[model samples]
Target chain A: MREVAAAERRRRTARLLVHGALAIASAATLFPLVWMLAAAFTPNDLILARPFRLWPEQATLANFAAASEAYPIWRWLWNSLLAAAAVTAGKLALSLPAAYAFARGRHRWRDAAFGFVIVTMAFPTVMVIVPTYLAVVRLGLVDTLPALIVPSIPYIGFYVFFFRQAMKALPPEMFEAASLDGAGFLRQFVDIALPNVAHVVPALAAFAFLGAWNIFLWGQLTLASVENKTLAVGVALFSDIEGAQSSWGPLMAVNSLAILPVLVVFLVARRSIERAFANR
Target chain B: MRGAHGGSLQTAGLVAPAFFAVAVFLYLPIAASGLLAVLDYHPATRAFSYAGLANIEAVWRDPAFRVAAWNTLVYCLVLVPAQVVVPLLLALGLREIAGSRLAPVYYACLFAPTLVSFSVAGAVWLPLLNPINGVLNEMLIAIGLPPSRWHTDARAALWVVCVVTFWKTFGLNLVLWYAALMTIPREQIEAARIDGAGFFRRVRDIDIPLASPTAFFILVTTVFTTLDDIVGIIDVLTGGGPFERTTNLPYLLWQKGLVFFQFGQASVVALVTIAIVALLTFVQFRFVERRVTYA
Candidate 1:
């Protein structure tokens, strides 16, 4: 009876300790974002006030209103959305069949080609920036969306490889059955393979969207006009180029706005996001 | 059987478009960069000369290039360990925490910064570090410390950049380390505990050794990722300013090629940077493969 009581106490203590540790970690992780949100809502004058108040005396939308007026927030958002959509669509359309072939088709050079794709990832992106710029200039694609979209296609080799790896995990019997049913290769992909790999589509799309949206170097170097600038490059323009004073309130407001779409995507696709990392 | 043969050919045909598209758009540009590095090609004059080793030699001799190289080395040296260690420590602390219910909430909080772009991170950090009217300054003043000029001061700028980069990326590393930690067999840990091992001993002797492979993987990838792609942070934060103290090789490539229109020289810098990264990655991979034991 005494031993049983001791065991129960030990179990209870373990549970309590675990709960306490989790609470502290969760708070630490969320602190910066909570602070950002609070600062966003706090009146401008109260933001830098001493002692760092957790809650503002009064909440206001003046920062957001000023942010919109200070920059082309709507235009930047539209540009980002369009570019991200195009890149995601382009990557999927291009990667799907290639992945299918690599996964399902039998060929002598299959492994070699796949290996080539992986090896290319080792090439530092910075090394190719200058040459790519030259190519874009030669193709008259500077300042155009195609310049952004086209360069991204080759970089999707990793994505294609990931998809192929995922597809390889599916049973091969399905392909054989499809072939027996008079379905050709294209038909089989449409019917059997697509359905099997559907779960990975959203995850891949999220990866591509985040990648294309946050592309700052390519956009900054390639796009010359403010009209063509994406949200990242636009927000960067707020920095004082020549020791001019910068507006902290409007800058933070714009920064917060710029991250909203990605934040929304992450929240909505939380499962897929977790799965992508989990699988990796 | 006849359909199978035909199906294979059709599949290959279906895949050709993508392969070709990537070759033209991705591989072709990379190849062109290599070719351009050796030739003296001025965009303005449309002139081309076989400069051979001249551009490479210039990059080697330039003091500014050397500074950029040193800055990159220092940044990577400091960041790789911090990124790995902080996340690993957090994951360790997380394991002791119960209530699997809070796991998702914690993950969401930790992983939040990964979704946000580097540009946004730089912007947010800028105001917080501002000398005047900045929260950091206000906090320092309250604590009886002097204000810091953060991005403006040459000495402080690199550290500020490092902190911002860490904030933007540490979450991703946390997830990776956490997943790796999960893969450690519960039985082994329980056995170690039953043998009278303490918490730190179990972690240091058992858990870390088991997680070494994952840690190594993160290290190599982080080096490449940060070295290759951190130009965005430089552009947004310091613009490699206050005397170009923060100009790493990538930004230097941009400065030469775009800012100065010295395409030939920039290509040289890019080539050298790629060569260095590839060499280091290869060496690190080979070294880690011998030491890392996979469960």
Candidate 2:
């Protein structure tokens, strides 16, 4: 009985130690972001002053006003929303049907086609980006929203693979029952396959939205005009123009704006995202 | 049989749009990169002339290419293992607190930075890393330690870049690791403990093997993202500067092709980068795939 109590005490100690360490690590990991948040609301002079303030002396809206005045912050935010939404929709539209085909439809060359799509997952966008940019230039699509959205959609290899796996796990009998009800292929896909895999949509949507919204290099190259830039690209531009000066306040403010929508999206979808990744 | 035939046709129709777009944007560009590497295009004449092995030879001899190649290797070597091991450790710790209220807080905090774009991450770090009015330096001064340039120092630039990149992106791997860890049945570990297997032995003999599939997935994705995502951070933070200390092959490709308009040389760099990724992937599948337990 004494030995068991000793072991229990040891286990509790270990648990406390582990939890304590994790808490410290979490604080350190979040410090940069927390600092950015604090700086965004702090006055610029206090930010650049020595013995740096961890929290703002007085929170102010001046930084946001200043950031918007300096750049088309609102316009960039709109562009980011448009580009991310369009790209996410395009990916879902194309990949859902294709994944349905791969998972349910009978075809001789289905695996071959799936292989063809999945192989591109290995091809980094940077590898093909040069030629893609040149193609955009040739088509007179540079600096346009399509240039950002259209090419972004085709990198759906991971999405298709994921959705196909999700769809394949559905019982074959479910689809057979739908077919017995005289449902056509398109009808079965739209009504049965898609609805069954709807749990995955939020997860894939979060991934696609984050991927598209966080587009920096492509947006930088494609969207040349300041007015056309996404929030991701605009933040970079704000930093560059502001340079290594005392404008950390406005820069952090812009940075906050860039991350706000995505953070909200991620937090809202966190549970489904957790489930989706856990299963896959 | 006739209905099955019609289903196949419909399948083809369903797959065609995605296939076509991927071909044009992804596969076609990949193929065109190869073609453009060998053929010289003149803007003046709007004509292409075969350049033979000139582009390949040029990139091979270029000093910038050599540095970029080395830096790329350094990145992969450092990032791939760190991303794999660190996250697995965190995931194990997280599993211990699975049912507790603190679990969500840990997940939310760790995963927060990963959701932020690379550009914003870079922007956030810029002020903190600034040598002169930066918070980092101010802290150092307060502690009676000499302040140092973070990304500004040539020797430290690559490491700084790596640290920031790791900070920004490691959460994805952490999530993947956590997910993989959850799949391990409790009975197996309890059984092992009953069988007198120590902690290290249990982890080595069971947990590691069970998690190998996610480990392999994490390894491949980490390398790819390290190549693609670092460019934005590099652009915003150092611009691959402090004397080109942080320029990897992808950044080199961007610089050569887009910045310098040397499309031929950039194509060569691009092909080399692709070859490196392909080779690493092949190696992983050949060697690591065998050990990955499907469940």
Candidate 3:
């Protein structure tokens, strides 16, 4: 009886310990964000006075007002949404067909073709930037939305690889049936292959959306105009303009704004995001 | 098979658009980078001429290039291991608390930063890591410890970049590790427990090997991201500042090509970075992945 009691006590202590550790780690991880959230609502002067306060003594939306007034924050947000949508759509449009081809098409050069795409994933954008930049300049696509969206689409290596895996997992019997019914490759792809991999679409789309939305280096290089910049790039510019002035509240507000859309996207697709990352 | 050639041609047609985009935008640029590495560019006249190995020699001789190379090496060495092991440890901790009411909440909080852009992340940390009025310094002072310069200090700048980058990115690997852990059979663990396997023993003997493939995935992706993705955070936070202490190869390329218009030098750096990536990837797949015991 005493041994049973002692083991129960030990288990309880271990559980408590685990929970406590997780709580602390989570808090530490969240401190900066939570602080940003608090500061975003608090008045600018109060943020400086009460740096450690987790709650705003007097909350206001003026910081967001200031952010919008100072720079084209709304425009930046719109640009971000437009670019992310375009890039995600472009990636899917390009990748889905390519992935289907790789998974189902049995040809001598298929592996080599896939290899060519996959290898580009390993090469960093900086490696290709000089020539890509020159090409863009030559085409006069600088500061255009197409420049932002078009070049960004080709780095679909992981998407193709992932979609291929998803496609490969689908039962071959369906494809065989479709083939027996006189379906060509394109027909099989659109009618059968896409539907089977529908579950993976939201996850991939979320990832592509997040990736395109958060694009900094490419956006920075291509989007020269203030209005053309995405939220991520604009926030950096906003910080540069406001950072030295120590305008914490408005900056935090804009920072919070930058996180909101992705946060919504993330929440909506949380399970899918987790599943996508979980894949081997 | 009937119409096999025709079917193959259809497949080729389907793949052509993506292939064309990749070929023109990606491969052409890569090929051009190699050539550019060996050629000199006149920014004013927009002229390119073959310069032999001078670009390579110049890149090799530059102190900033050397510093960038060293910082990149340090980044890979430190961040790669930390990115792997820390997430694994956190994932294990998370695994312990899995299925609890708070598990999802814990995950959401940890992953929240990752969903934010690097620029926003940098912006979020800027105030927190600020020297005087920053919350971090405030906390330190409240605890009776002396506050220190975080990202502004040359010695601490790279480490700050490391921390911010790690913070913004580690959750992806954590999820991967957690998923890997969840896939491990509970029966195997229970049997091991019955056979008197201790926690460390079970982790070492079973969990580690079973999760090897995920570990390998995390390691490769982490290395590439540590090299590639942190450029934004670096651009925002330090701008490779405190006397260029935090400059990595990617940042160096950015500064050289775009900021300084030294395209030739940037191309050299690009080639070197690509070679490193290719070598690392080849070595990982060729050697390390061979031993991964996939379930």
In terms of TM-score, the best-performing candidate is 2
**Model 3 TM-score, 2 decimals:** 0.96
TM values, all candidates: 0.91, 0.97, 0.96
Candidate that beats the other on DockQ, 1 or 2, i.e. the better one: 2
Model 1 segments more than 4 A misplaced: A1-32, A42-57, A241-245, B1-8, B98-100, B204-216, B292-295
Question: What ranges in model 2 sit over 4 Å off?
Answer: B1-6, B43-47
Model 2, B1-295: lDDT tens digits are 3331227889999999988988888989889999989977675565778999999998999988898999999999998888888887888888877898998899878888998899889999999999886888888888999998999999999999999999999999999988888888999998997788976798899888988878888888998988888888998999888888998998888888667777778888989999999999999999989888887
Candidate 3 recovers a fraction of native contacts equal to 0.65
Alpha-carbon deviation at B65 in model 2, angstroms: 0.9
Predicted structure with the largest lDDT when compared to the true one: 2
DockQ, 0 to 1 scale, candidate 2: 0.69
Better of 2 and 3 by lDDT: 2
Location of the lowest summed lDDT over 10 successive residues in candidate 3 chain B: B1-10
CA lDDT, every model vs. true structure: 0.76, 0.87, 0.86
Q: Tens digit of lDDT per residue, candidate 1, span A1-280?
A: 9977986798679767766765676675555556666666666666645425556448887877877776677788888988888888988988888888788776666667677665665666676777788778887889987787677656766678778878788887887888899887778778988898887688778878898888888888887777777888787776553244344556666677777898777666667756765644
Off by over 4 Å in 3: A1-9, A243-245, A274-279, B1-6
TM-score of chain A of 1: 0.87
lDDT of 2 at B33: 94
TM-score (C-alpha) between model 2 and the true structure = 0.97
Error of 2 at A177 (Å): 1.2
DockQ, 0 to 1 scale, candidate 3: 0.64
**What local lDDT score does residue A263 receive in model 1, on the 0 to 100 scale?**
77
